[model samples]
Target: MRLRWPVALLVTLLVVVLGTLMGSRTPAEAAKKITIKDSMGRTVRVPCPPQRIVEVNGDVAELICALGDAGKIVGASSYTLQDKFFTSRLKKAQDVGKSFTPSVEKILALKPDVVFGYGKFLKPEIIAQLERAGVPVVLLDCYKIKTMAEDIRTLGVILNRQKEAAAYIAYFEKYRKLFADRVKKIPVNRRPRVYLEQYTDYTLSGPGSGGAELLDGVGARNIGAGLRVPYPKISPEWLLAQNPDVIIKACGSSITSGYGEKPDAMAKKRAEMMRRPGWSRIAAVRQGKVYMLSSEIFTGPRAIVGMAYMAKWLYPQLFKDVNPAAIHKEMLKKFHGLELKGAYVYP
Candidate 1:
């Protein structure tokens, strides 16, 4: 038998033995993992410094891009691709379809090491499907002010970009403290009554909404806070009765107001809102306090930028030295590596 041994058979046996020895150190053994709790409170084990990422949430994508890990993204939601910043940074990332209903097959095809999604939009079944296929899904809602810092910290740990994350947190805390200190000085009676409308007409953002949280953070009273639903459609009569001191309409992508975009569309929306029947009697309308805010800033890590603008709008005298536009410009240049050239707030 030894004399009759074929060269190909010997080679095959040698290769199999070598593979067996090396296979003892499996891929899981070779890759290190870290355990962290996602925004949804699920304990997930994700590879440290994930090389390939599929980010379904645009907000998280913004944070990832800001952290200077844009090159790690292999796939992104369609909404993320539409954003100027994300589009510029993630030009090569594959589109994984809609944020709410991302294509599982498309995401799997990208072979991402981890997936990041908004807690609200990512269904449980979708998460299970991804996990079953050996993909880890990390839900981080970067839009909420309350959890944004912690979310960023967790994200830093995952991306191995702790330094960048800390820097952003410091920037965030600076304005957060500034807003808190100045807003606390105003008397409750003097606080501006703000009516925050969503992209849809008559749809008001209530307690659970980011818009409501922003208004509350800036020491303004959200007229719709008492509503049971997060987004409630109210009658025009009810809005008229509120007589808000300030009106802020959140314009979505449909209205177009962001980097390199014009303000004409936002201006048109604001004018239409002001022209609504019986709107002239509203304090906000009469005093020209109606403002249109681009959703780009108001609902993500950049919400602080939107807060700066709101602070200036709600109390011009107090925040006179605080230039929201300058802060916004700095944020874009420092974090996203973009020059500010678009209108975010409408006159």
Candidate 2:
């Protein structure tokens, strides 16, 4: 079987090249991936159930943990990765940056297999940079209640947490349905015309906000819905005209950096600053329906909290009084093993 050396060498090289080409062409031979589109409608192919993933938002990071895959998250938002609830579960990972802006060099250095981020916070330029560095980024948006359930399902596909995600979605849907059915029992005359003051100044979290959506779901109407802006600038005159039955100041006017301020103190400060002659006559101010939104659950993973809050605010007798504080405690304990105390404030 011995042949000329030159001919034998040529034949061996051809065989090796043909075998490599065949392996590359075969799906079974190459690394298999499940193709899925991110929240932004960008096709991102995740390799093998995501051994290493980076999250740029607290909700996304928390979702990864709820999915029981903390080990896979290599990088997370500085705020979330440090949260006692999330950081205790994921000890090794640390601050990549804020959600909207992350250190490109640090992320590239990690060489992560997949990156999970929020649509509202993570910038498109950052996503582009990650792609340029040859990384896969999956953006998810769960900002509003309407699309929140769908967003959870999308996360399930990417993280392979479909079962847990489905269960959570089902739980929220069921809770909402039950709450709505109860609302239907209320006579039209008894339904409260509520004003949900999500914020002050330019950033009034409006009908599109989670709080307003919940109010609408439970039969209470939001006065801000007719304002005609995604987040309209509020004028004192409009408040006078609407004459809301109940005013829920879910949160105070906070610049992003100055969040978690007391609603009463903030209101007093605003009142002194703007001496609108008729402002004091508003029904909400007279009745003190204004309240603070004391938890992060209103938008993200705290659908249970939102339900509890709405139930208590709208129909206290029917709901046996939903305690947002207690619900926060249970969720933190079950999901992250942390105890919460007095997070929501009525004062």
Candidate 3:
């Protein structure tokens, strides 16, 4: 039996209304917006899975590669290209200029889903340009020991690689706890007075600095902790007075890279440290307790590796079995799928 025209018309209207409602919900369901506050405390709404990304910081980009989302990265900064480990995988990504001063034109050209940058490094105008172009940008603090893990987790969620991110976080926590547990066993009086020399002779990282955070994590004392500034240029006489029990010279822009491999160069540098006016009288020099560290090992997620080395250095007997080199190899191999060879630390 055929339905009446009025009833048929009403049925047709209901069907059309239901279809419209379903169609409207499809886009929202396909890609949901997730609200997250960046390190700068700016509220942001990003797509659940960002397919195209631009990471300005090499360390943050490294973490992205480690989380198995390197394909998602469409643009990167200068440092990422210079990184030997990351060069091959990220070679295809567009060079977005310096870590701090990326080309707004290039970034706009890529039409990335989102852009990640270091809060301290990125310029205000660049961020403003991206924001004005309707490109979502999230600034992060990649180096701080307190928030590094959380930052990784946040990236994992944004990239939809939570499982991979959790694995990395777990590895970081394990090593972090290992150092903390062993260091805690030592008494406060036993903690060594350490001077963290940053690349240059007198430049030091004190309290509130990245080096200070690592030393604190490993339960070591920063002799420069008394300094008012985070990165201060102290006088050689002041260092002589502090008489650090241990001296860790960090290799970075101010110093030549790959010098750690050259025994003669390293010896010359070490000799120079020993010959500093009144340095011979200092406890660290007198006891021959000096070490060379690489900045790469102490930045970003790799800082935990630096802490392990410090723990072993600070208390050899307790962390005798903790091999930082082996851990470094495993982390790079397992997370990054790269077999990198280099000397990051030296006696």
Candidate 4:
């Protein structure tokens, strides 16, 4: 005898059958997810090998490009759009706006699989907003020397470019160890006292900052290391009183010195620093030890390149064999697939 099923039961059975036939995924396909603990210490589950990405920070975007996945970038911040290297590669990407204030609607419209941002700079609200929209946001700051290796490795895993990431890390370690081995041998008293200025005059890079770490990595004693804040502004008299043995100015976008630019702006910045009132008595000025470094190299993923220059400037005899320009060119060629054509340091 045939039995008649209840309408509700029949509907449930039909729905289940249709769902299995139309929406079921294989185990391998269902498991295509990666769990990542971002720089902010938040665990995020991202789709494996994100095909479309929105990178809000230029430094982080540079890392993505270095990983050989520049083609996957679908949206970028204004900073990345303005960068010659990024513009050349990400010609088809849409600019969502500034890194600090990205347009959520614009990013959502792109249907990105993942978004990259700097934990320290991008607001938590923006990250939350993206997450609510079913988009994953990974905070990775590629600037700090201490965490750079881990950050790159994480990116490598997320992008399935483990080989490229390992190579990049090895390259960074080569120079890092070169500087570390040589710097460690020098006595503490022999290390130069350095005053590293930020983008603005009288603004200093203090403890816990990437700039301060760069100086420390090269065995230079940062005069402002004892400051309570990361970036503190001091009076001119205070700067003169420090009498730092070496003065290094970090120039940002205000001074063009990186990627298809001339060294004239850096030269002018150096000369202006040299002409500061009462700075003539400073040891750095008296001995012609004042130098200018573009923020492009000193504050981001290529900070080691800046460190190489700093090492040479502070201890010319010790780092004579270390050519920062050569290293810069090699990095550009090997990682970013670009030729070195701009001035990163000045005479």
- Best candidate (score: TM-score): 1
Cα lDDT tens digits, model 4, 1-347, are 99999999999999999778758553323437889998879898987788889999888889889988899899999878987767689998999999988999999999888999988889889988999998899999888888889999998998989999999999998888888888987888889999999988899999888998898889998999889998999999999999999999898888887888889999998998899899899998999998889878986889889999999999899999989999999999989878999878888
Question: Tens digits of per-residue lDDT for model 3 on 178-198?
Answer: 787777867778899999988
TM-score, predicted candidate 3 vs. hidden true structure: 0.85
Q: How does residue 167 of candidate 1 score in lDDT?
A: 98
Candidate 2: residue 263 lDDT (0-100): 45
Q: List per-prediction Cα lDDT, in the order shown.
A: 0.90, 0.67, 0.81, 0.89
Which model is ahead, 3 or 4, in terms of TM-score? Answer: 4
Instruction: Give the clashing pairs for model 3.
Output: none
Instruction: Tell me the tens digit of each residue's lDDT in model 2 across 1-347.
Output: 86666978999999999887886442222445788876677777776566777888777777777767888777877877545456467787856887789988778777688788876568889988998887878877765667778888888876677898897788667666777878887877788887666656424546556667777777887776666565667776776787777665544224111122334554554454234567567666676655445445555777567667767776788888556667667666666555664334454
lDDT of 1 by residue, 1-347 (tens): 34788989999999999888878653433578999999889999998888889999988988999999999898999988987766678989999998989999999998888999989779789989999999999999999888889999999999889999999999987897788888987788899899988989999989888888888788998898788988899999999999999999998878988878899999999999999999999999999999999988886899988999999999889889998889988988998878888889999
In model 1, pairs of residues that clash are: none
Task: Report clashes for each candidate as comma-separated counts.
Answer: 0, 2, 0, 0
Off by over 4 Å in 1: 1-29
What's the CA RMSD of model 2 in angstroms?
Answer: 6.3
Ranking by TM-score: 1, 4, 3, 2
Question: What's each prediction's TM-score?
Answer: 0.91, 0.77, 0.85, 0.90
**Poorest 10 consecutive residues by lDDT, candidate 4:** 22-31
